[model samples]
Target: MMPLRTIANRVECEIEIKKSRFVGVVDRAATEADARAVIAAARMSDPAAGHHCSAFIVDSSAGDPLADPKQQRIERSHDDGEPSGTAGMPMLEVLRGHHTTNVVAVVSRYFGGTKLGTGGLARAYGSAVSEALVHARFLTRQRREIMTLELDHAEVGRVESELRRHAVLVLGTSYAARAVLTVSAVDADSTAALVASLTAGRVTPVRSGHMYAEIPD
Candidate 1:
């Protein structure tokens, strides 16, 4: 299964100018459904807001039996009540500038006493999105490879030491007469190298596929 991609953490902040309020939220979502749920919750939170515009990107190819191609890019935008293009497009530009993928941006606006014209609205929306990005938490996207390595009790300590030297992430350890270690690496080659190095041409580890980042702190 292909692991889901998303921001490593969450961010919440607000910006205002000329009586216009831009409440921006950056959230980490694993699925498209989760992203929609966030937008729905935001709308419900501000029922009387002037507009509740949103944008998001997602990729889901987990356990594809047919080997369906994975979507490298997914982009969406909603204008809410603002004139078309004024609210959504500018927000999209902010995402593009940051080269952000598999992320969502939602801007909820509460109208002030005055109306922001088309140009003014675009500026406000874009600036709000930009600020949200600035405050957002980022995670490094890494290909996670899981594998099992076998070693006798005597070699366990040295094998573990080698794995750590290569920055290999140990997921678990099991002992049933002999010790076996479950490890995660960034890619297939790394996993293979670790197995070969620790086993010394005697033991081998089974291959596990990619892994994705969990929510960041």
Candidate 2:
């Protein structure tokens, strides 16, 4: 299978002014729509802000021809009454500068009453976005296939322990005549290894298919 796409867990950046404050939020998004939704939500938090300009980059899953090979992405800036290019372009540059992908960044500004002019606005916006990014916490994602393991009561403990040792996620368990375990592992190799080791070459797992989750930091 192809490599999994990249994503961000969280990122923070802030900009300071002699008077006003502008904050930027960087977050991972799965789709174009998801990215826009995050931007909208960010704006709602500070509806009174003078401007909320943002940028985003989203790459499609493997084999998605429509996805831009370059990085499915978007960058939009709202002047929020500020002169055009003064707010959005700088924010876009910051996102691009950081090589951020599958992510969206929104910078909200509350005017300080003093005009910073074009250069000042650009610097302020970029600086604020950078600060927010500095504060971000992030996790890389991995692709995995999910499987449900059914084992007899006598074998459940052995299976669970082995899976744990291999870093498999036992999402949940159901106890009936047999123990049903929801297992998630990074790849088919890992899954097969765990099953072979846990079942002692007796039982085989039923794979559910591919899914994704953040690799623990």
Candidate 3:
């Protein structure tokens, strides 16, 4: 699966153009519902704002296994009462230009008794989002396999220490009849080989599943 870029934290920026105030919020949205929820929250926080224009690009494959393969991404933008192309599309273009996905940006406009015309509105909206993204921290979400290494309690600690030395991400260890060490792995083949070599064929790692794990951008 392809690695995607997204905001690491929610960021908001305020910019005034021609007396119109634009407040933009950019956040991580792992799913379509998450994107809509962020937009809704933005509106509720600024109920008196004239317009809450929003744009989002979500990689459907990151969360939904049943998502249509032909549609790997879900992109949406809304004008929210502004002129047709003045608000949403321009914000979306800025997001795409920044190569951001699984992210949502909403620019709430507070009318300043000034009409900036369609072209001005587009530039303001796009610029607002762009500025917020500039101050926003970002990360890359990449597909990683989660594996469970079942081992005897006595051997678990030593094995885990050894694995960590090899640069493996050990998530956690759960106790049961045997110790189960959950880890975010590079791949199944590499994990299996490491486990086999570590325990001399006494243990085999089980593939739990796959998930998109955040990494440094």
Off by more than 4 A, model 3: 59-72, 171-178, 201-208
lDDT of 3 by residue, 36-123 (tens): 9999999999999999999999977766633432258889999999999999999999988877788999999999998999999999
TM-score computed on alpha carbons, candidate 2: 0.65
Q: List the residue pairs that clash in candidate 2.
A: 11-136, 12-132, 12-133, 12-136, 13-131, 13-132, 13-133, 14-131, 14-132, 15-128
Tens-digit lDDT string for candidate 1 (1-217): 4343345667767888778788988786555777788889888988878798888765554323222214545578899989999988888787667656567778999887888789998998888878877766665454567788777989888888888788788888899988988887766676676667667778777875546544343
| TM-scores vs. true structure, each candidate | 0.78, 0.65, 0.79
lDDT of 1 at 65: 21
Model 2: lDDT of residue 172: 84
lDDT per residue for candidate 2 within 100-179, as digits (tens), equals 55777788888777778789888888787777777665544456678888888888888888888878878788999888
Ranking by TM-score: 3, 1, 2
After TM-score superposition, the amount by which residue 82's alpha carbon in candidate 2 deviates from its true location, in angstroms, is 3.5
Per-candidate RMSD, Å: 4.3, 5.4, 3.4
Q: Which lDDT values do the candidates have, in the order given?
A: 0.73, 0.71, 0.87
Off by over 4 Å in 1: 1-5, 61-73, 174-179, 187-199, 204-206, 214-217
Quote model 1's TM-score. Answer: 0.78
Winner by TM-score:
3
